[model samples]
Target chain A: EDKVVQSPLSLVVHEGDTVTLNCSYEVTNFRSLLWYKQEKKAPTFLFMLTSSGIEKKSGRLSSILDKKELSSILNITATQTGDSAIYLCAHQETSGSRLTFGEGTQLTVNP
Target chain B: AAGVIQSPRHLIKEKRETATLKCYPIPRHDTVYWYQQGPGQDPQFLISFYEKMQSDKGSIPDRFSAQQFSDYHSELNMSSLELGDSALYFCASSRSGNIQYFGAGTRLSVL
Candidate 1:
């Protein structure tokens, strides 16, 4: 079975702080990893990493994948209240292209 | 861009009743997926539909089913509702191997 585990299920930090959320997975036929931010409603896609050691970044948020370690990390720097949301990591397998998601890490950026 | 669109933003149902949710994928997208999310929990994949066919089904009961209409619209149906079926149902669409875009979601409350 494909499974994803996320650490530090919840966190609280002041604005301008940096945060790193971790996700580890055990899946068959690994193809890619995805990160999403869930705010008021649906989750918004953040990044998708297919290869190892390559970093994807969008402004204050960045993510990297380590295939050997079977893990990925999402980093947020100089956070603001607007950046507060549940960060979800999902892994997709090639055999079925099915996504198995982690429990997610909740981030709260206080002003 | 117009993101994925879902219908019945809010639904209230009693046990033994049936509930149906609808979704319209983003223009030009070819894949559609469905997920359920409870409070404080990550979105759970229910199914994925591609090219008018069901691609995957998750750990959901047989009461839950989905159908895709020509890769543009999809519908999720629950034959019989249970208390545990209460959750926000999300619809997502993806291009050819691209990141998914989500809908605002349909909040289903089983009473």
Candidate 2:
């Protein structure tokens, strides 16, 4: 079975702190990995990483995929309360566009 | 900029009732995907359509069925509703081999 697992299931941090969320996967015919931030109703696209060692960034958020290790990490710098939400990681296999998602990491940034 | 659209932001149905949820893919998008997310759980893939044809399926229940129209819109028809079926149903659209943009999701509550 294709599976994606995320670590630090829940985290609490003060504003301005930095935090890292982890995702590891085991699947066949790996194609790409993606990250999303789900707030209340919908999950907004964050980044898509396909190559190892290449980092994708958006403002204070960044992510990288390590294919050799079958894992990925999402880093948030200068975190703020606005960054508190469930961070989801998913991967697509070459067979199709379907995504297998992780349990997600719930982050809470307090002021 | 257009994004995936889902209708009936919320639906309430009694056990054994039937419900139909709709989805309108983004302009020029040729694929649509359906996912169900229960409280505190990751999104689970239900099914997907490519160019109005069933392309892939996942852990969808036997009581559920879905189809895409030529207009690139889709609908998920769920019958014999169970309490476990209550969840957020999300519709996502994407161009072939690209990132998917999700809808705000329809909250289904089975009483």
Report the number of the highest-DockQ candidate: 2
Q: Which stretches of candidate 1 lie over 4 Å from their true place?
A: none
DockQ of each: 0.65, 0.74
lDDT of 1 by residue, A1-111 (tens): 888999889999999999999999988778889999989899899999886679999999999999889999999999999999999999877623556789999999999
Which residue pairs overlap in candidate 1's backbone?
none
lDDT of 1 at B38: 86
Q: Identify the leading candidate in terms of TM-score.
A: 2
Candidate 1 local lDDT, B1-111, one digit each (tens): 788889999999999999999999999888898989988788888998888888878876899888998646999999789999999999888877568778999999999
Per-prediction TM-score to the true structure, in the order listed = 0.95, 0.98
What digit string (tens of lDDT, one per residue) describes model 2 on residues A35-104? 9999997899999988556999899999999888999999999999999999999998863478889999
Query: Which digits, one per residue and each the tens of the lDDT, describe model 2 over residues B67-107?
Result: 99989899999999999999999999888759988999999
Residue B15 error for model 1, in Å? 1.1
